[model samples]
Target: MAIKPAEIKKLASLSRLVVDDKTITDVTDRLSSVLALVDQLQSAQTESIDVSRPFHIAQRLREDEITESNKIDELQATAPEIYNGFFAVPKMID
Candidate 1:
């Protein structure tokens, strides 16, 4: 799984990634090691591994109901200018 200089250039061109010669060498080594580990895992006996060993997840549906309502009097009190029951702001257009 050792990536060549030419292969790295090809991958960089396709992915639009900018990599120098030094960076290419480093990335090649890292990627080759990762691929080697993946190749080893692929050959392993994973069929006997239990799926529920990690954790079990369950989704709970909530009832659609208005639990609490907003107080309009408190909201209107904090307004700069209140005409009936609305906050006034400066006009955007000249």
Candidate 2:
């Protein structure tokens, strides 16, 4: 499955990639090697295999905890504008 120079050119055109002659040659070589590897894989044997177990391992639950935070009055005191209990900001865009 050797990739051709013409095919690489066509691929570059379709992909909208600007590649020089050297890059095209390199890409073509790499593509050829990848295709050859795929062909080799297609011809190999894989009769007994369990492909699902590894990807479906049981997950653990996260622990819930009671947390403490600063009071709103203490935080709003640091802001320039505080309407009731909320901080106000200038309107910029809709």
Cα lDDT computed for each candidate against the true fold? 0.80, 0.83
User: How well is each residue in 14-83 modelled by candidate 2, as lDDT tens digits?
Assistant: 9998768868888888989999888887676777767767667688776686565768898788999988
Clashing pairs in 1: none
The list of candidate 2 runs beyond 4 A from truth reads: 44-94
TM-score of each predicted structure versus truth: 0.42, 0.41
lDDT tens readout by residue for model 1, 25-50: 88888888888877776777889889
Q: RMSD to the native, candidate 2? A: 11.4
Among all windows of 10 consecutive residues in model 1, the one with the lowest summed lDDT is 51-60
